[model samples]
Target: MSSQPTSNAPVLHVQGLGFGFPGHSLFQDWSADFPAGLSLIQGGDGTGKTSLLRLFAGETAPQAGSVTLLGMDAVRQPAEYRAQVFWRDPRAPWPDTLTPLTWVEQLPAHHPRWSGEAWRAHVAGFGLAMHLHKPMYQLSSGSQRKVLLAAALASGAVLTLLDEPLAALDKPSISYLLQALEAEARASRWPGRAVLVAHYDALGDLPWCARIAL
Candidate 1:
């Protein structure tokens, strides 16, 4: 890893990252610096985009190397490292009886900087208020995704990772997401925050601070 930073101070720094499955290698000795702002990780399906996000989330341990967010090392100080990072696999299973409203209500206890106002506003904006009380298993795929969308923006985590956020979203919801992301950048709020989205294409024409190809 280079001791010099070519850009702004990194919110997330990856050095010598190496990982892979049996008989199939994905990344080896990869290093990069992610500064504060929205960054895109673009690649085709099955190209290890989700795998990389999992690595960053500390959900999957890397075979070798380090993932550092803010200043905490994912391997050395997991509890403190994850505290400032928000990453939820959209396809992850939920409790049978869990409701979006209840689940979201508990997020703040885990994420110190979580914003209730942002959550409520996004819930309303995404038309998810009507389904908040319903069981997660009962909600439509699109509705479920909207819940994650709302939470991601409201979390206020220093590092936020969303893999394929647009996967099952509705047209209006997609439009709202684009607008919300753009507004987030324009507001210049959370300059220390780094939002990374894994997608096959750019999110509209929004000005992305960085783009990494997996």
Candidate 2:
């Protein structure tokens, strides 16, 4: 579970990348490489942090340049590339009405690495008390965020692309998540990388954080 991206190439490589919406450019000529630790994407509101993360996640096509993970081209090998990364966004949709436990149970059993008990413990760690049978939509926004966080942990992706990961979370939940992430980083001999976009500076004490402010 090392945080390395599985190749000599950077975990994330961006070269001459640019994106625009209507009359404004969100980002342009942005070239950077994310190495084997947590890289924080920091910016004020409307600075395109989410857009850039979406571009990296292969959810949105960048207007120019290239986004590559390991050695695979992002746009060319989208499915393979995306499978290695997990994206968590608040605006993203959830299962229509699945309960937390049922949703986790429905995942294909082929992924032996992600166990139900482990996810259950994770959810509990975040102070979410709902049983798996409870409807997800019935939970508060913060509680829903907890569910999504646990789901991301269970997904077992090498690269973690988190958008506002700390939003709507309490202090204990935040501490719990940071510990979980630290353990995730330690589990791998050379785990993939994690890129977190957040306004909070709580990441200051994280083991290794490279900051890039826009």
- Judging by TM-score against the true structure, name the best candidate: 1
154: Cα error in model 1, Å:
0.4
- In candidate 2, clashing pairs total 11
Error of 2 at 36 (Å): 2.3
Model 2 lDDT per residue over 116-183, tens place: 66577797898766555678777778888888788777666556677787888989998898888777
Off by over 4 Å in 2: 1-8, 106-117, 193-197, 200-202
**What is the lDDT of every predicted structure here?**
0.86, 0.72
TM-score of each: 0.94, 0.85
- Provide the lDDT at 80 for model 2: 72
Task: Assess the local accuracy of residue 56 in candidate 2 as a C-alpha lDDT between 0 and 100.
Answer: 85
lDDT (10s digit) by residue, model 1, range 11-45: 88999999999999999999988887888999999
In angstroms, give how far residue 204 of model 1 lies from its true place: 1.7
Top candidate, metric lDDT: 1
